[model samples]
Target: MVMITASGKGTSSTKGTNSTKVASSTSGTNSTKKASGTWSPPEFDESLPREVTVMEGEPAELPCVVFKLKGRAVSWIRQRDLHVISANGLTFTSDERFKVTLDNATSSFTLGVAEALRNDSGVYECQVNTRPKLSRPVSLKVLVPAARIAGATELFIRRGSTLVITCTAQLHPTAPSKVEWVHNSSVVSISGGRGGVSVHTERGGPQLSSTLSLAKVEMRDAGNYTCRPHSLTPASVTVFIVDDEVPAAMHHDSGVGRGGGCPLPALFYSALAALTCPALCPALCPALTCPVPPYPAPS
Candidate 1:
């Protein structure tokens, strides 16, 4: 006798002259096989908030998170008109107020502008380094408080002359912002809080103004000075100061002040001026006058 069994049903037997056979019925059970090579990574959620906003001199935070970030790195970048303001984990901005911060799961990059200015408003980008690069860009609009300079920004002081810089900034809501005179890279004088130095604000967005005075100016005070408004994204304006005497000779010649007669001096000065000036000569020194030769015109 022989018996046969199927996966689902019971066994059955069949008998012949010298042999018996049994077979099982295949009733409800079903079997299916799946291939092994059809696996893929999870899809990324690219529709998160990509833009942020903050007031001038205020601290702003940008958040970036990824759902499928297994082997990727996060990077933050600030995209100005034609420049990358910030990149990688470091800051590349000429402005000292911008900085980057990273978290365990999310990336929170913070930009602190001591006192926000009109120029501080722009687009900031957040990027993820993965097989397929992912990026999110946010637009930041900085609201500058009502502020203006009341006195002379450049002062011609002798070795021991007195110098004073007056800065006035006004903001809506009339919260008193900090005002200080920054000499070189360090704080030389501060006013406003307690007795250090400062000005008061009034109601209804009144214009606030203050003066940073240097009773006796010295050679050491011959660098760049900035009036910073201490607030959440503080705004600052730089004022350049030099000794009473003119520069002996510029590192490079800029033709700007070398007017009248000496082509060599003019050329030299122009070159130096071009290098020093933030913008090139074609824009700053449009009307350049050349020196005439000693010989008179033939009559």
Candidate 2:
């Protein structure tokens, strides 16, 4: 006599919906043939794995094994709505994300799920039709990963300052396979920074973090920087570089006063906001009470 075992799987196509729950069961029935002494019903093992965990959008496998099935059917069914997904290695639903494979050498039936969704989380059953029937239950759990930046979403820094960005992935099973930084939608070379660019990563519990550091940053670095992980959604931050040039409103006694090459005269006008005569506003006069400080006299 030959036994059989099979697993059931559900695929997920959407973020919050798990399309299939892969469930697996093993059979304990003995493959020994007697001289017509007695007939034993198919034995189902309940000690098999009852819980399976997988990341969303990834494939999941469920296995069901039946020993000494001896011309019996192995099938998988959803416990929530009692929907039969596969029967005797044949698919019952039109969902192409699911498929069953039966191996004669191992007497094992396996279910495969592709692109798993969040809604596919549920209990699945592997069943062997017999006199009273036999069943094994397994639970499917889906995990979703989220990405974030440790510092502010937007950043402002002076030129020549060191730049550090930390990207953290929460609820991830492991660290991202690849982490890269992008500037203004273009890939930033890890080795192309002024003071050199370096990346370091650490894992703590279920959270994984990677830090990108650029030394002696410059104005060209000012732009939208994005932290992209292969598995999670990318996070972005805007970088603004403060200029080193002084504002023109402040000038020394070199006659380079408000009206003398003072590019930002608006600073004076803004100070005399209460002046009704905009053209004759004394605020524009360098000797007058200007809003901005006058440049220091030559030593």
Candidate 3:
């Protein structure tokens, strides 16, 4: 025969015919329940941003917030190559630019990369040591803005004529604040000694354009013209001024032309030949009828 008794302390006693046994199985179970009920696993704060953007050559920081961390360790991993960058606020990568910082008060683990480059743009993961692990993904973007002229890399303009040059800058994922024009290594300004010089800028979404105009441009105004954007590569175009000796038709071309086309004055002179029709009319205008010249009287 066996008899069992239970007490408030979660202890149990069993009495047998030949022996008495006391077991505290329920006490162990209660202790386990209490411990589990008092502790919670780490979890990420979903309110924080998951995407970050920064300009090339600038610093980039990605933050991960985790609460109820207890004693769990945090790590940052680069998803591009599954490379471990840092763990428990200690850097593991060979790159000196990568660093990890933790704020105990806020429970934020931040991964910082100095002097970010275009190649550094990718998704990174912050992990907390837990069963199956708790992770949050963050994306980094590195932008590189560049500038280009509206026309060709070289321009030709007639002296004493209005010269206009338009420059366009592409600032992706960012808006351009301003564009500066440099003429022959000197910054161009409307208030400068060169009168009638004007610069007009307009913004259209991600592209910013600035037009430079010089009224009655002189030969001295010919040189390299560059459009420079803030912290970005500048674009340049060579400007050549034509003298009065060069016919207007010789220098006038679509902004992209290098003044290599056949001169209009030559075409005008050819048209005059068609009127005379001295056997050259057929070559100038195939549809024209040339009058036959009377053979010189047998002399």
Candidate 4:
């Protein structure tokens, strides 16, 4: 017959049942924890944009994109000093030219720089704030209108000569580009800054003019000269110099009169006699052969 056990006698049976339930519950909790831990969140792809070119004094746009982004932040940094230019859809500093525009769906960010300067030429980096932090680097080169001398040219000066050459070119933004004299393509004799040279900018559109001068001429200074304009093409020209002395013989001859070598009357008579001989010799045939006067020899 089925009978209910008393509390003290049933203690061992209840204890065993409770222990089995506790073991099962502990195993279920451990399995659930492991499942949750195994699932990983999607990561952001931090990659910099490609194919970017900009001109000097013009606006530049740099694009940075983050793909598969879940909960990560994006940042833009200049490579020079790892300076943070922009971050997380917000500009940290109040620089008027720096702006960030984002395309939420495409996960792309664009950094705009207005009126780019020479200092803006460098590498830009894109970063994603995720585990291990994904990053990509891009290079930006700013091009200004420039001209340089073709390698086929050179400059020269003769001994005891003057050094004179012209370096000419055109530039953008209506400012004069620097013109420098490069010797052997290394030694910088004159540049835009202070020294024995100077640079002057005339108000004209994209056109630059400059001249290089050697104040005191020397004999040893004769050689090839190159005119290189700063950030522009180069032009080269040759120079020649000579000593000021005149030859002594040339001076002596200068004093002689045009007819000094022979008298005019003597010259006329000699011409007349020569003409008469051809005709008279035929007529004076036989014993009357004309005794030709030894025509007065040309004085």
User: Model 2: per-residue lDDT, tens digit, 1-299?
Assistant: 12222222222233224322221111212323343547767765545577888878778887778777888998899899999999987999888988888897766777778877788888888889886888888788877766788655546556777888888876445554567778897887765535477888777776678888888877688778888877678888776554443234333322234455433443344344334343333435543333322334334
Q: Each model's C-alpha lDDT?
A: 0.49, 0.67, 0.74, 0.57
Q: Please write out the lDDT profile of model 3 over residues 1-299, one tens digit for every residue.
A: 12233342234222341233223666677888999898577889999899999878778999898999987899998998999898887999888999988898988899999989999999999999898988999999987778888655656666789989888776644544688999997999999998999999988776778899999988789889998877678999877665534433333333212343333333343345535544563354343232222223232
For lDDT, the strongest prediction is 3
Evaluation by TM-score, superior candidate among 1 and 3: 3
Angstrom error of the Cα, residue 259, model 2: value is: 50
Candidates in descending lDDT order:
3, 2, 4, 1
Q: Estimated TM-score per prediction?
A: 0.34, 0.48, 0.54, 0.43
Model 1 lDDT tens row, 1-299:
23334522232222331242222222212211223344344333456555655555566665555555555565666577545545546776777766666454553444444555667677766676655666677677766664455543333344555556666665544466556556667775345232333333233344555566564555455556666664523334333333334333221233234543334433443444534542333244444321111233234
Candidate 4 lDDT by residue in tens digits, 1-299: 22445664587778888999999999999999999778454343434455466668778888776766665788988889988988878886676887889888888878888877767888887787767767777777777655543322323223444455555565666454556665444444554332444334343566666655664555434445666666565655433232333222112222212333422222232235455552333233221212123333344
lDDT of 4 at 46: 37
Candidate 4 deviates by what RMSD?
Answer: 23.3
Q: Model 2, stretches more than 4 Å misplaced?
A: 1-41, 45-48, 54-58, 68-71, 104-106, 114-119, 141-163, 168-178, 183-197, 200-209, 215-225, 230-232, 236-299
Angstrom error at residue 272, model 2: 23
